[model samples]
Target: MNILLKMLLSMSIASVILIPLVWFLKKVFGQFLTKRKSYYAWGVVFFFLIVPFAFFFVQKNTEFLWGTPSEFAGLTSMVIGQNGIEVERSTQAVIFQFIMDYVWVLWLMVGLIMLVYRIASYRNFKKFVISGAHYIEEPDELDILAEAMETIGLNKPVEVMINPLISSPVFFGFRREIIVLPSTSFSKKELYHIFLHELVHCKSKDMYVVFLAQIFTCIYWFNPLMYWMIRQLERDREYACDESVLSYLPARDALSYGDTLLHSIVKSGTYKESHAAVSLHENAKMLKERLEAIASYKKGKKGYISFLLLLILLTLIGILLNFYEAKAFIYEKKQGIEIKKEDTSKKTEFRAIDLQNANQDVTIRKGKTESFDLTTYDENSKAELVVKNGILMYKNANPNTQSAIIITIDADKVYDSLSIQTTGTQIKISDIHTKTMRIKGGVIIAHFNQIKADTINVTTGSANVHLTDSEVNKGMKFNGNNALIHFEKSSFNNLEMTSFLSAKLNDLNVQGGLSINSGGQLDARNITTDTLKLIAGNSGNMKFQNTFVKKSSEFQDNESMLLQFDGVLNGQTRMSIGPSQTKFVIRDKMQKYAIDAQSSQADTFILNQSIVNYPFTQNLSAPNNITLTNDSPFNNNFNLSFEE
Candidate 1:
């Protein structure tokens, strides 16, 4: 997902930069270079679009010291955070798999549908060309076309066919070029200009340009800018053909050629409506632009140096902006140094997680997997500490009776991941730094003052979790039922929390993004998230306050007990507040807002600021539709306010 998004975003940035550059060049240097040269400038922009994807495929992944590509790194940083929160190899693989299975499939499906539609349209046009057209047998007309082709140094035989359905002369096919002309009568001078224009199209291989444009258009139909680029390319192709045809004509006959072009265009209903071929006439406005160019032709020396220099510079810039350093160890586990334990008689063993039944109060912390110190107190209870692989386990020897056991853990002595599962266990852990912490099926009360981990996964039937002054780099996942999760002065880069029956969140702050799925009541306070996605079942209410949101937030059938924003909202927000009788209180009067409300019943709007006003505020008692917009030009100050 990250790589795909980066490739797309890089291409967008390149296009946004290169298109304007080309447009400016054309506007300023149109007179210096011939239209044929201007038409070729668009190839630079096309190359810019492909640079990012090309770099993505061939770029090598490096170590931690490897830096991101300068151009695309900025865009990636803007979304993924500056510190680059590192996820486990398994987690990264899962995310990549999900995207490949779902998102990529959808994109390809839509693209294929569009391609099929275009191919069908093209085939229908081919059928028309084969059925409704006849080869022109006029010796004089055929000789004129052959002579024009000969003058252009062309040797390929192109059939000249006439069709009444066509509005203008079309140069069709690349490998087998064919000219399709309208069935209207043409004067000798008109035939001369038309033959030269279509023949120039064939000579310049503009049909190949049309074919490539069609293919790209079908593939990138989802991007509006691509369609616009293809349109611009087609317009320039015609301009280039016009310039080529006019250059061969005598200076005195330029006006005659322009008149013949204009008459054919007017008789073709002011535009060419064909899609499968390039027409001699495009539209009245485009024809006018071409006519203006022809009228002001100066036959100056073509500035090949300036054009080539611009193309080379733009290509280098594209390459620089699209490439980034990739991490070589993305699929490997992190390594850590080992520590020696006090018991020299037998070395502590490294192991994976121990999931056997344990009936002891265990305080587990991070330590080196190769060595661990297990200390036990209250010897009468017969508490045992077992070490296997890397996991350190404490189990009460007698499980038939209630036995009180206390285990003190010293994880700072070594580097190891911690896993704790206990029944009716009072676990107190503090000042623990580990790679990951996994808690499952425990009535555990864990307190941490300074805990740092790559990830924390908690799965409990019911538990209370609290942390202060702690930070998880990658993220934290909570899976439980009726869990009370609270954090004070702590943060996670990403959070995927799921709870059912009932769950409460107190002062939870996510630095990156958050995803929540619950079937119970949520009490949220002082929550800050870069982006939030919430899915809730029918029963519970959502409560929020002092929340800061960035980018966007989505709510699905959320029924809240109370909703209010006391902090800042910086982006677009979508809410589907279900039948929860929701009311929003906005205390910040300085934020700009655009509110679109739809309901069969009238909704109240209380605007207290003079800088903001809604015209439909008076229709609160009647069923009405209201749109409130704070049309402020300034960014530092907001103009809307809402309060009850």
Candidate 2:
């Protein structure tokens, strides 16, 4: 599940829970809340609708450091065969990827359409009102507007317009306040009440609140409760404005204000309210409640302070709950399996083991007796474990099951061979001795810790292999499509790796030789090998750091591959770089080497920070030889310097 989608779903769920709670509270304790405070309560509901965007931004900015990349994020698996590298993707995976890619785009397109339609509607309404309206020039009306502004403590200039098309008084515009009124005959007191109501709306900035509500409605258009919430919010805004207008007037005029509201309701059919504007009259249905609220209104103590504190506390709790609900929903959506643990111990003697078709985490270690611990979805998903013909075989019938399976082999005897083949599993092995070991998988994440093995072979489509504090007495070979291979504080007699996409090697010590053939990038650091050979077939750059090649080393690239070496060369080194730049930094300044450079086209060679013309030859008789050859149509550049 996408993080944004999870957050949105969580927000919707929280709104569903919160909207009803607000209604229940208002219905039960309507008198305890001032109209203004009740209006502010709706802000809590808006918080859930708007806070998901904040989570989305945070998720995007921190994704590289904290998020787990999808297994198929940028991986194109290829298998090397007689016909060369062939791209491989399952039909189900391809269809799933296609669907997942377009679902979010569809969601965004619909949301944008809703938003644009609402905005366009509001703009058209504003334009229509302005086209049919004119400034109020009557002296008495100007005096009334000035007095209303003064009563509301508003210093900003307001435009009062008389629109013959509108029936009720409308408050519009965000930056420029416009109060549009119909050319209807009313008493002086009724006119004053109307002017005061719209002016109070402008002072309180209710237009901006209505705009925010419209945006929220567009974003959560799929949630039916959001529409109801918006309606409730508008009702509260009018109620709060009525309360404020009554505060500025005397107690005796409250009945007069109620009469003005009734008059506006009678004339409400001529104009429909917009999401971008606040009107003095909504409809006849809500007019009765507004009149009742006005009749029963009172100047209460500062009880809103306590209500605000409680609202803040509830908002915090709601945010926390939404976060957890999102996380749990994502977890359940991704891993829709229930796990049960089963542990079994056996004293059967076996010299070899074979585990296959596991789609879960598996841990193998040396123990007193042969024991198997399984964490699977159900009993039907358990593995078949038995010893036959000196080989302990373990197999999972349901290859798609995802969980944990741990096996402990007897440590008294060294196994002759141990092989494991899995689909999507993380394998961990430690403190076990085996003559030969083989691991094959589609997506493998294996960690080897302090294991003694004669030979280790790993083949996978995509893998992240980590060998730390381990030893391979004979040799180690790895063949994969996309791999991140790391050997830290590990020794190997010989290491050979063949990858299709890219490979990363780090902190390895080889006694005999190191060979790498990659179609993509190859990065090796802190490596010590007697001999080294690297061949890249594609446009992947090769980088080596702190690598010491003792005997002879050869590096070749079929395409334009940048070669960067910052290491020591004990004997002879040859580089065949085609139009790409090359940089070599000698770690041992005292080691002398002769350079033989050749190029088919123009080439630049820099020796000890000085440019040298090629074909360049220096000290050809020296024991340590460095040969550089370039056969390219473009100019090739090479730089050689001693480490500072």
Candidate 3:
């Protein structure tokens, strides 16, 4: 839960940065971007919006979780315990922490209200467009509309209505397509221009674009710049329509069309105030811009360049918003503890450590130079520490005793092979680099940081693993049950993780194969792997996101597992979900795959290929097996197998 809150908080900070960038780009390049293309650029914000959440999900160094343990205990009773270990906080810290904890609820409430309002308004507008509308059958008007449709290559049937209540030409309705024009009589030329304009909208599918823009605006309403961007998008969409309409007319007729638009300005209602339909005459200001654009419209090669430039700029902005650097840590005995970068050019190899029978919280961090320190809160506690042959050992002199212990290590040491064996000890190690690191523990809280190892082997009974800013060169594996592993912003050559409880790997770069055998739950996000193999025995939920599995991968599971994928599924991959339900929410552009599977019980397969909205689940029963070939043109190349 704290991790989730941290993500939201990071998003808020990113919003502050992105909002200004968005507005600045609009102001500077507003004129360079092509009309329709500029509207599409607004979609870039949707991508940037997710960038922060993804970034923070990986980096553990954040202000929200920083500080001494005792300084944070009072903010929540959950952190307080019956043992009377109290951590005091200043009033300002408490207030700030409280807001950080609960701000997501506020954000959710605001977004929901905006979503409901947009939906209700859409329904009401649909109703208004439906009731008391009379279809126009004038021979001349019908002929003009038919000619406009033919010119735009639209053969689909449509409804043309004369509605006195409507102030301007409007387009709505999906199944029963309708165009509501003002009841005022029009000359042949004006009517032709109006039909052509609305037909251009129909041909370009601007209505759907407008609707999508509205939905995104509502969801991100907290960002005021999004509102500004939406308004610009609507303007650009109409401008594009105007340009298209002029393309079908003679160059000399451009001014005449502009004159028609200017005349419609007075008769057209303030459609900008209405979010229901794409209508003519947004307001007098937009009307002037449309006239100017129409007057200066010409065929050119500059539109392509502007489009390319816009794409490049948006891509850079996205990268910058999500970029995070590794922070440095340097501590000295005189100044207590401080986080600062320093050169480790003259560092020695890291020392080894062995821990036995630790039941209290243990912290290990970096120091200035070659040194070691051990401190305990309870003097009478039977905890003893010794360093022999460069191997630091911690022991409890009494058999049945436990107490808080702090072990500080020098930051400059680079251990060649470091190993740890703990029993019920909560250990935190940070700011040390090593060649190889291994751990075998039981029921502990272990936090590791800035540790580079060739191989990391973690074997625990029941534990919580929080590791960040680390790298494993050759391979890393986990063997445990009832363990919660949170490994973030780490790189590894190969990963072999097996647990009966749960594990989450976030923002990791894995260059080799990944194998997971779990009986509980598994959640991985922002990951990149060469190949994957998963096996689950009992009921659990598995999720993968923003991950690339390039080589062959397979999953064999017998229990009912809820499997979900929100990223790209590449390479030759297969999954046997057994009787469990598997859902693939494809967010990648290049989609292609193959799946060979078998099922003993009744199985259902769902595929959503349509790009209109989210793909719907298509359930199909397969008693024995189902072969999904790569020849399909559905959602790229996605393959999986299942059995029960």
In each prediction, how many residue pairs overlap at the backbone (N, C-alpha, C within less than 3 A)? 13, 0, 16
- Candidate 2 lDDT score at position 529: 96
| Candidate 3 TM-score, true structure as reference | 0.48
TM-score of each: 0.45, 0.47, 0.48
Prediction 2 global C-alpha lDDT: 0.78
Scored by lDDT, the top model is 2
User: Which is the leading candidate under TM-score?
Assistant: 3
lDDT of 3 at 190: 80
Give stretches of model 3 more than 4 Å off. Answer: 1-33, 53-86, 266-273, 324-644
Global lDDT of each model?
A: 0.63, 0.78, 0.67
Tell me the tens digit of each residue's lDDT in model 2 across 1-644: 45465456557877887788777666555667778887888777777766763244333323321234444433346566999655555677667666655565667778899899889988998998989888988888888888888988999999988776776789899888998887646667888899899988888888889888888777777789988988888898999999999889988889889999888665544767567888887777898899998998787545676577658765876677666654543421123222233433333567887877666677899887777767777656656677777787776457666667688977667889989887756888888889999988876687888878999998987777777888899999988778777777889999998884666677889999999888777778899999999887677788999999899899886674688888888788888876667788988653477888888776677888898777988777777888988776766677888774
Q: RMSD in Å for candidate 1, one decimal?
A: 28.0
RMSD of each: 28.0, 16.8, 20.4
Full ranking by lDDT:
2, 3, 1
Per-residue lDDT for 365-405 in model 1, tens only? Answer: 44333333334444566655666555666655554445443
